[model samples]
Target: MVNSLSKRCISLLPIYKKVPWKSIVLHPIIHPRFKFTCWLAAWQRLATADRLLKIGVQVPLECSFCNNAMETVEHLFFDCSISKAIW
Candidate 1:
């Protein structure tokens, strides 16, 4: 047990939650742009309007489709009713 614990190779395995990539992001025929979008969405790093506004971009900061909430990456992609409908 001590030998296995001391092996650097054994410590290199992933220790985080597994991403569900096979069914979603790994289809051979899926468009590359869509794959990149999925990767960005997973990280909540998409440059939505609200994020741009905070960074000094001059885009409108309201959800254009929802019209009532701040247009953030999370709001536009996860919490908006329109986004839910599309998903």
Candidate 2:
């Protein structure tokens, strides 16, 4: 019964696609902390403000740097005016 239940749970999991940037993120020269961060970002699993609010944490939705838009991974990394300038 336990074996059957485990199989059922596994089958219910969403199948993820191959991550194209896996090699670059997991390169040996990359620092372990940076590698872990990059892996999370690649998976859209970084604890950005939008994700925090979705999980019911009370956080300001606006970007802390630009205060111009909702704080999402894309916005924080690429779209925010301050980040854009830094990049």
User: Pick by TM-score: which candidate is best?
Assistant: 2
Every model's TM-score = 0.64, 0.74
Root-mean-square deviation of every model = 4.4, 6.9
Model 1 residue 27 lDDT score? 81
TM-score of 1: 0.64
lDDT of 2: 0.91
List candidate 2 stretches off by more than 4 Å: 1-17
Show pairs that collide, candidate 2. Answer: none
lDDT of 1: 0.81
Error of 1 at 50 (Å): 2.2
Per-residue CA lDDT of model 2 for 1-87, tens digit only, reads 999999999999999987788898979999999999988888889988999988999988899999999999999888998998998
- Worst lDDT window (10 residues) for model 1? 17-26
In model 2, where is the ten-residue run with the lowest total lDDT? 17-26
Model 1 agreement with the true structure over 1-87: per-residue lDDT tens digits:
778777877788779877786468778888999988988877766888866777898987789898878887778777999989998
